[model samples]
Target: MHLSIFKWSYIVTAVSLVVAFLYGGPSALFLCVILGILEISLSFDNAVINATILQRMSDFWQKIFLTVGIVIAVFGMRLVLPLVIVWLAAGLNPIAAFDLAMNPPADGAAYFPDGRASYETLLTDAHPIIAAFGGMFLLMLFLSWVFEEREHTWLSALERPLAKAGKLDAMAVLVSMIVLLVVSETLAEDAETVLFSGVVGIVLYLAVNGLGTLFEAGQEDDETTADTAVDKALAGANGTDTTDNPTADPSAVQSKARSGGPTQLVRATGKAGFFLFLYLEVLDASFSFDGVIGAFAITSDPIIIALGLGLIGAMFVRSLTVFLVRKGTLAEYVYLEHGAHWAIGALAAILMVSIGVHVNEIITGLLGVAFIGAAFLSSVRRNKALRARGEDPATVGAASH
Candidate 1:
């Protein structure tokens, strides 16, 4: 792997550490470093999922992802999102929310000198809604992946059946609705709030993912038209009839020309690329919801949280994403995507479970890491087996679901 991809992340880490020390001395710097490590540990699966999507994007959009997308991930999700949550949940103005975050209670007190709830308390109060929305969105993502028929199956016993069942129409949606209903009725303290938030999440996922697919199809159609035109021109010069012959199967042409299989990726451009970018940002936001909330456990200072999670953690995640795509890691380790999605499913379940009972952040981080690590080991074993059989490892496990 090239170290140059991570050069900026290293620079940012160093500079941020210095700035943290200057801002609040040794303690602040230590907290920042700790928070950065926490973010990375909790989000390793996020980097894997991101690489899968990033590989499908065009070069220009990929650059935009590293540039423009990072700003949104850092400032938008890390800094502003907390303030907004506090504002809405506490019924305060944006300025008041900012003030509240800027001046947090000392030593992680639950309330201020004025007897008002502290920033951490207010944010914690808003956890149900956040978890509901983010959980449902991630659940939908996992369900869709599970439902799709893939060329490769990581856990054949489980995935093969799921893929077979996926033949049924709207299976993913039906299952998601059932899960939401069950959770809202039995598990959630705020049933009305959970139901509303979960429905919003499901709807938003459908809208964003549906629009992306539509735009991607349009892009493919345009390309197919261009290719057909060229084919006709060449046929004309050769004095051959290029009109629809008995051998011309449009479905076969489509299946062969487009990136439809599990392992293949078509670089999306124009409006398709924009929607894909949008989808990626939303996915990142969902993944970060837990991290943002969990950061309060380390420290109540919003500035420090942002500096650590945003600058240090987010940058490294992006760098890891670029590394995975450049090195064909996803293709090499076919089960990695499966593991990442499984981690996402677990996260969604944990988020829902947290609505009724508190869950330790450490448990959450460990579960994700365990899934990813298991997947990596499974991939290694598969490669070794293929080598022993005198087959090319690259010839198998071609695409993501």
Candidate 2:
């Protein structure tokens, strides 16, 4: 609710709009505005999920996310990534890829661009692979959320059943692989490529998630050790017998406090933060894949896509994340997280479906909005019910299941 949180977003939106206008004139400016709105609508749920992670990160890292992370989202994913996909897929070097991107063939005149496919053509050709990878990764995120047991439930009938089903070992992985196999066999033309890409997606998700968990465990251990060291230092300073053994090295305990107390804890936290940041980046990339591809439908201009989706849209999402964290939006709207994950599940399904059939960007945006909107309303009702029963809504469980 604080307007200050969105101060930069407003400034960036205005600057990006002016740049859009200067770059491509009135029509381009209009399209840029439209694209920005489209990106926001498609990515509102993304902000919610982002806030869940951002809240746990230190303020320093949060600032890095807004600054350095935005640059990667803007350039790395939206601009350079498309080019890289084309380069790798077509076996073209950087120069050739950039040249091809700059000079896309005219619509419907897809003979070939100088004995090679056009930029848009190649990117479209790469959709199945993108869908396979992004879809499976997002599906894993969704399944893990849905299958986990929780005290709170948005749709108890559906969630309760899923939670019970989750007791089976590796239920999420098994279901994801089965879905990947089904899609690859039935939907994809090149089943081998789709299957391979999907498997890679699943593996990458597990690796990143596992690394994050490992780092988090290390961080906890470091904090515990530092706390013990600090306590011993305090006891020694107070002339208390902290240890049972009279021969214990008091100097050693003091050295640990002086050397490893705050410094070692900070290092462990930073390492954990780095991996969590990496996880957020990957999640953002997976979410943006469909948007990046869908942007071509509006305009074939990469600069415009970056201006709208990156500068305007992505900046807004980051600001919204800050707002959610500061305002404790998720804690208030308990079902909101469930809604975002459901939206993600829907998106994963749409991505897999688009491997064979084209889905309009409008449909993709609407489905996300619908789920989130419904969840918000449901959350409001729950709050009212709790108030009527004389229970403090804020005290209820809001775990990130």
Candidate 3:
């Protein structure tokens, strides 16, 4: 598993090294390395959230995530997304936008002699709208988790109350909308643009995530019906009528089906899985918005950004995701998901706030790391307590389910 995961990292490193060196000697190579490191640091929480969702998917879907999904992440988001954004914002043709990105003017003047706009300047100018969209999307994600009732919690004091409040339908969306309004009012410029982008973000989240939920719910209903039918058939085969057994619990049968291992649980495949894939991709894009903008601090070269931050850094994140899923890391560190969501909430707020102020990328990275580290420590402590009580941590986790 380690070999399979690290192999991509090694290949990306070697390729990035060669590309960076050829681009502009040692200094460029160093910059590329720094960008890669920065991407990984900023995106560690992304890997954890991805693992949480990926583990529910079938092996085939998981493989798709690592293979085809990475391509979308590296090229589609890192390369084409910028061009598309520039094209849309500056009203330039795709070719012109690409050229402007590759060769930004020295004076940073956006309008060209040929009347084409500089892609970099246009992209930079679009940051507030971009931040608002991504920020709102991520904010909704964090709120949804906190609002939903869960078995384990890292911060019960706050989480318990939030979960209770979450019982109200669409409460997450309501809170997000209110926050978006507040943020829009605070923005000095492009208030309308930011608000519009935020509305689109919320709508997309609802449409995509809600569609995935509908599919998953339908699948679960089908599985339940099938399991109930099979249980009745087995009871008949044993010369016992299901009706005769007064204590025959239908929910127990469903529970057994769910816990019966990989085959019994409906694999996230077909239409349901595809929507889930879309959700993952959207989630990833939201997470990368800040990283994409922050990469400009390192260099404005689109190729180097694609090679270092997109290729190398994103590959490692994908690899880490698979590693987490395969190792059942989430199952072991029960509070890890909570911590990741908290980090996401912090990131969402930071992204929104950054519209009015400059928030350091280092602070963002450190906040995520701090939450994750604290969660790890809490998990360790809980495991130790369980061991002292003469209980196996693994057994306890399974039983809780």
Task: Tell me the number of clashing residue pairs for each predicted model.
Answer: 3, 0, 0
lDDT, each prediction:
0.87, 0.87, 0.85
Better of 2 and 3 by lDDT: 2
Judge candidate 2 at residue 179 and give its lDDT.
98
| TM-score, candidate number 3 | 0.90
Over 1-401, each residue of candidate 1 has an lDDT whose tens digit, in order, gives 57789999999999989989998999999999999999888898999999998898899999999999989999999999888999989999878988888888887789978899988899999998998899999999999999998887777788888988999998888998998898888888889999999999999999988988898898777777767654554454445754644345555544544644322345788887898889889899998988989998888788888889999999999999999999999888888998999999999999988888899989999999999999988888888888888877789653232
* Winner by TM-score: 1
In model 3, the Cα lDDT at residue 263 comes to: 34
TM-score: model 2 vs. ground truth: 0.88
lDDT of 3 by residue, 34-142 (tens): 9888888878899999999898787888989888998999998898898888888878877888888888766756566787656666887888888899999999999
Candidate 3 segments exceeding 4 Å error: 107-118, 241-263, 395-401
Ranking by lDDT: 2, 1, 3
Best by lDDT: 2
Which residues of candidate 1, in runs, are more than 4 Å off? 237-265, 397-401
Error of 2 at 283 (Å): 0.7
Candidate 2, overall lDDT? 0.87
Which whole-number lDDT from 0 to 100 does residue 391 have in model 2?
86
Q: Estimate each model's TM-score.
A: 0.92, 0.88, 0.90
lDDT of 2 by residue, 97-129 (tens): 878777777764444656767788888899999
